[model samples]
Target: MPSLTLADLDQRPELAPAVLALFAAAPPGAHHLVCGLPAAMGQEPTAEILARTSGMLLALSGRQVAGAIGICPYSEDQVTLWGPATAQAAVAEFLFTSTREALHLSRFGSMRALIDTRNREQRAFYRAHGFAAWKDNHLYECVLETRTSTGTVSRGSLAFKVRAATTRDHNAVISILTRAFPDSDHCLPSLAKREADGYRHYVLEEAGTVVAAAAVQDAGRRGWLKLIAVKPELRGRQLSRRLLEGVLASESRRGKRTMALEVLADNAPAIALYEHAGFRRKWTATIMTGPV
Candidate 1:
C-alpha cells in the first residue's frame, strides 16, 4: 500500500469538483459510492447535498486524490457518512479510519453509513470496521408526466382536504411527527431549517384537525419526500394515501418531473402505498452505525 496524506475540504476548496466527479461516476451499488441521498439518476441533487455536508476529507497519494469521505451532522451526537470513495481498493480502509478519527474530534459521538444492499464489499468493509447493521431502507421514485390537473381524488363520502402547513399548524404537525418518528432527528429544529431552505410541508385536515402531513423538498425538476406521517389513531382510514396523492398533485402542479423517497424495507404498507401511487423501487440499502 502507498502512503496517503489527508486534507480537509475546507482548506482545499478547489478539489470540490474532483470529489463531485468521484461520486458522480459511482452508482448506487458501486463500492466507492456514497449512500442515503435522494435521486440516484442525476448529479445536481447529489452535489447540492454534498455542498451542505459538515466536513469532508480527501486522501491523497502524493498530489492526486485517492479517496474521500463526507460527514453530515444531523444531530448533536450523530453524523451520517456520505462516502469513503476511493480510487483504489488498497486505500479504502485507510480513508474510512482516517475519517472516523476526524469525526471523533468533533461533537459527534457516533457515525452511520447507508450502503446499497447490492454493495456487499462496502457493507463488509463497514461491518469489519465495527459498524453494525441497523435497518434496511428502500429508495423509491415516481416519474410524473405533464398533466393539466390532478383530478378530485377522494375516499368514500368524505373528500380529502389538503393544504400547505402554516405557522399555526406547527404544534399539531410536531405532535404527529413526534409520535410517528420517535427515533428520527427531523423534529422541530430540523423542520424549521428545512423550511427555511425551501422545503414544504403539506397537511391533510378532517373537520378541523390535521390528520396527516408530509415534508417535501422541491429541487426544480425533482422532488423528494422527506417524510409523511398520519395521526396514529386515524391510521387505516386511507388518509395516508389521500395525503400522498395531494403531495404528488402539488409536485405535478409545480412541474416537477420526478419525486423520490426512502422507506424502511420492512414497511410493507408504506411500500404498497408508494407502489400503488406509481413509485418504483430503485435501490435498497442497509443503514449501519458505530461509535465515532
Candidate 2:
C-alpha cells in the first residue's frame, strides 16, 4: 500500500459515511464525538475545510487511510484521531507510517482516540501507540428505560420558571455559557445549528431573564443534552440540577430512553450533579495536546 495522502479525503465525499461505518463496526459507544460535520448541516466537507478544521486526512488507493485528527473546542489542547483501516498488513503499515510522518509535521500539541469501553483490543492498540488513560475525563450515560419518579416541579430555592426557549433566548444562553465555561468553544456551532434544525431548547427564567438553559437534540430512542449552562452568580443554588431534571423528565416522557453527556474530568461540581441524578460512568476518553 502507498502512503496515505491528503488527496484521498478530497476525492471521497462519502468520508463521513465511511467513518460512521468504522465506528459501527468497532463496538457500541466507541466514540463520543463524531469526526465529521453533522448530517443535518448538509455540508459536503472539502479538502480546504478538512485542512482548515484540524489536520488533513490521508488515504491510500481506497484501501487504507490515516493521519486524520479532529480538533475539539471543548478541549483546545487535544485532537481526536480517525485513522485508516484495511485487512492488508501493507495497508496497516502504510497508515501507521503515514501517521508518524504527519505527527512530525502536525501543528497539534496532543492527539487521542476513544476506544469502546468493552473493546479491550482497541484500547490496547491505543496504549501501545503511547496514549495514556485520562482517568478524570470519563464519559457518562443514563438509561431512560423507566422514567424517574421525580416530578417536573422545580426543586431549588431560586425562583425560576422553565419554558421552551424562543428566538429571543439565543443571546442570553450564549452569555450564560460564556460566563460559566470561559474556556469552552464546543457548543456554539451546535447551538446555532439547533435553530436551523428546529431543535427545542429549555430555559430557566428568573426575574424575566434566562439564567440557566439546556438544549435537547432528538437522537432516535436517545436524547442528547447538548448544552447546559447557568449564570455564575447562581452557582451553588442547584439551578443547573433543576434545569437538567426538567429537561430529562420531558425527554423521558417523549420516549427518549437514554441521556448522554461529556464533562471535563476536573469539573467536580458538574460531575457530582450528574452522579447524584443517576448518571453512571460508562467510559473515558483522553484529550491529547501538543503544539497547534
Candidate 3:
C-alpha cells in the first residue's frame, strides 16, 4: 500500500473513470451528482476545481488505484471533502494521507468527507474513521422519462411573466435569489458562478419586478436546474412553478433528456411543486461538517 499522493490523480486518469463507472451503475433516477466530471483527459479541471477550492488527493493500492478524495477550506477551522471513498484499507490509508497533503497545500484545519445518503457502507466507513453525521440533504430527481406536460399553464393565469434571462437581467436575477433565499449559503455563490459560466438565467416577473428565478446549466444530455428561489412577498401564486416550467420547456426544446436538482428534505412545498411539474425523487446527499 503506497501513500496516497496528489501525483496519483495526475498520473492515473483511471481513478476518475472507475468512479464514474461505479456511479453509472447507480439505481435508476439516482443521480451521481458528485461525479459530474468528464471521464477523460480533460477531467483535470474537475480535479483542479477541487484542488483549488480545497485540496485533492488520490489513493492507490499497488499498481491498481483504489479511490480519491478532495478537501476544501470552508470556515477557519472547517474543511469540506467533496468526494471520498476507497474499497481497500490500503487505499483508505492512502486517502487519509492524500487528505493530509491537501491540508498542507491549503494550510487549513481538519477535514471531513461529504457523503451521499445511499452509500451507507461508505458512510459507515467514514464513521469508523471518526467522521460524524454533520448535515443532511435530500437528492430529488424528476423522472424525465416519465414526464408528460399537463399542458403549459397560461402565463396570464398566474399573472407572472416568465422569460429567458439575458446578461442584462443579471442584476434582477441576483436580486430575486438574494431576497427569496437570504440564508441559503450554498446557492448564492452558485448563482454568481452560473452567470460567469455562461448559463442562461430565467426569471418570473410580477408587476415589473422579478419575483422568482432559476438557472439552467447545460450538461449535454442532462440539464441541471439550480438557484431556484421565489420572492418572500409572492409565495403562494405558483410563481416558482411557472419559472421552473419555463426552464423545463426551454430545455426540452433544446433536446435535453433529463433535468436534475437537489432540495432540502424538509421543504415539502418545494417537493410538491416538483412532483406536480413531473419531477421525482432520485437520491439524497448529506453535508457532513466537523471541527477544523
List, residue by residue over 78-181, the lDDT tens digit for candidate 2.
Answer: 45654333444444445555656665675556666544455455455556667777643556778776666443453356455767777778788777867776
- Model 2 score (lDDT): 0.58
- Candidate 3 C-alpha lDDT tens digits along 36-115: 22111112233334434433456555555466665555556566664554556666666665566556766565665545
Candidate 1 residue-wise lDDT, 1-292, digit = tens: 5688989888998888888777766765455355434433333424566667887889888887887887776677888887787757667777888877777788888988888777788888888989999999888888877434353455666666778888788778888888999987666576677699778888888765788888987665778888899999988877888788888887888888889888898888899889988999887788899998
C-alpha lDDT values of all predictions: 0.78, 0.58, 0.59
| Best-to-worst TM-score order | 1, 3, 2
What is the RMSD, in Å, between candidate 3 and the native fold over all Cα?
5.2
Deviation in angstroms for 76 in model 1?
A: 2.6
Please list the residue runs of candidate 3 whose C-alpha ends up more than 4 Å from where it truly belongs after superposition: 1-6, 11-56, 70-83, 104-112, 143-159, 183-193, 196-198
How well does each candidate superpose onto the true structure, as a TM-score? 0.90, 0.66, 0.74
Model 2, runs deviating above 4 Å? 1-22, 28-79, 84-93, 96-112, 115-136, 148-159, 186-193, 197-200
Residue 24 C-alpha lDDT in model 2: 39
Ranking by lDDT: 1, 3, 2
Best by lDDT: 1
Displacement of the residue 159 alpha carbon in candidate 1, Å: 3.9
lDDT of 1 at 8: 87
Candidate 3, poorest ten consecutive residues by summed lDDT? 36-45
Task: Please give the RMSD to the true structure for each candidate, in Å.
Answer: 2.4, 6.1, 5.2
